[model samples]
Target chain A: MSEYTATVTVRLKAGVHDPEAETTRRALERLGFDLSALRAADQFELDLDAESAESARERATEMTERLLANPTIHDHDIEVEPR
Target chain B: MSEYTATVTVRLKAGVHDPEAETTRRALERLGFDLSALRAADQFELDLDAESAESARERATEMTERLLANPTIHDHDIEVEPR
Candidate 1:
């Protein structure tokens, strides 16, 4: 088994309302930062033992599908690297 | 001016206690997934008009420092690309 780190990034689907992002944008504007749009996401890094990068990605994707992301409202991307 | 997207990733500093990640790791284990360690982070994507990528990255870093991340407990990385 090889040590691998799977990075999963979960974002709200397009056209979905994100109150947190909206609030953050307002806060940034208040701080005199100029931005047209902002979006927020959650990222998870999982370190585990797997046979290959593909296997690590598969497990991470499964984790995202089952627990990390809401299928109806979220879109996630996963990347795996040897550690 | 050109359209750019600044991606900022914020993670807890090493040795910082993260209850959320701990909870998530346990949940994954309950679901029969094997993971030795897990860490969670927040990612922000900002879309803006800027003269150059460096300027966009600078603004994003400032945003991270002032609002997106807590300098006392979090470490952050910023990336910028043309949109």
Candidate 2:
């Protein structure tokens, strides 16, 4: 069993109400940072047992789709790296 | 100016009070996930302009240290990719 690391990011779909992101954006604005296209996302780091990078990516994808995320209102990106 | 993409992960130092992480972990436990070492983190994606990956990474590191995060209580890892 090789040690593989997976980083998964989950973000609310565009047009979804992201209170956390909004709050952060407003705070930034108050601090004099002006960038309107700000979004909030969640990141997960998983240490998984996998034989190869391909397998790790596939498994991470499955984990996101099956359990870690709500696909209807969220989008995810999975990155796998060897350890 | 190349279109460089950066993903910055900000995590609370271990032993810090992470209310959000705790809440999520409890919810997962209630759903029958028996994992004990669950932590939460934040990810930021930046479109930066630089001549090389090293420069992009350096800029991102500086950004995290200077503005995007509170280094006193948070740790950050920056990843740069081509867009």
Candidate 3:
């Protein structure tokens, strides 16, 4: 089996409240940094044994959809690469 | 001034314990997904008004270094693009 790494990124859906990111933005502003909107995303990297990159990505997608992200509130994307 | 977007990705330094990622990995395994190591990252997207992309990137780097990341435990990267 070939070893691969899958990167899964999750972000809150549009209009979802992102308090942590907002707080972070405010903190930056207080430090004299000027900026506008700030959105935060969660990225997950997974190593797997698979037949091919496609298979690894498939498994990672399943993992993302089922456990790594909340479908109702999060938008997720995945990328696979050889390890 | 022109508008730009800065993407700052924060990841735990190698050897840092990531319990949340571990928990998510275990949960994925229980659901029948096969995988090895899993790492999680925090990504921040910021909008800014700057004289140039270089300036926006500089500010974003400062934000990442000062407030968006904990240097003791995290390593971060920043990307700047026109908005």
Q: Which stretches of candidate 1 lie over 4 Å from their true place?
A: none
Q: Whole-model lDDT for model 3 versus the true structure?
A: 0.90
Docking class of 3: high
- How do the residues A1-83 of candidate 2 rate in per-residue lDDT, one tens digit apiece? 57777778899988899887677656656765444245668987766677788987887777677677898999998877776
For model 1, state the Cα shift of residue A66 in Å: 0.9
Which scores higher on TM-score, 2 or 3?
A: 3
Q: Candidate 2 - CAPRI tier?
A: acceptable
Per-prediction TM-score, please? Answer: 0.98, 0.68, 0.95
Each predicted complex: what DockQ?
A: 0.93, 0.31, 0.90
lDDT by residue (tens digit), candidate 3, A1-83: 99999989899999999899888888888999887799999999899999999988888888888788899999989988999
lDDT tens digits, residues B1-83, model 2?
57677778899987789887667656655765443244668877766667888987887777677677897899888888887
Candidate that scores best on TM-score: 1
Better of 1 and 2 by DockQ: 1
Better of 2 and 3 by DockQ: 3
Candidate 2 clashes between residue pairs 3 or more apart in a chain or in different chains: none
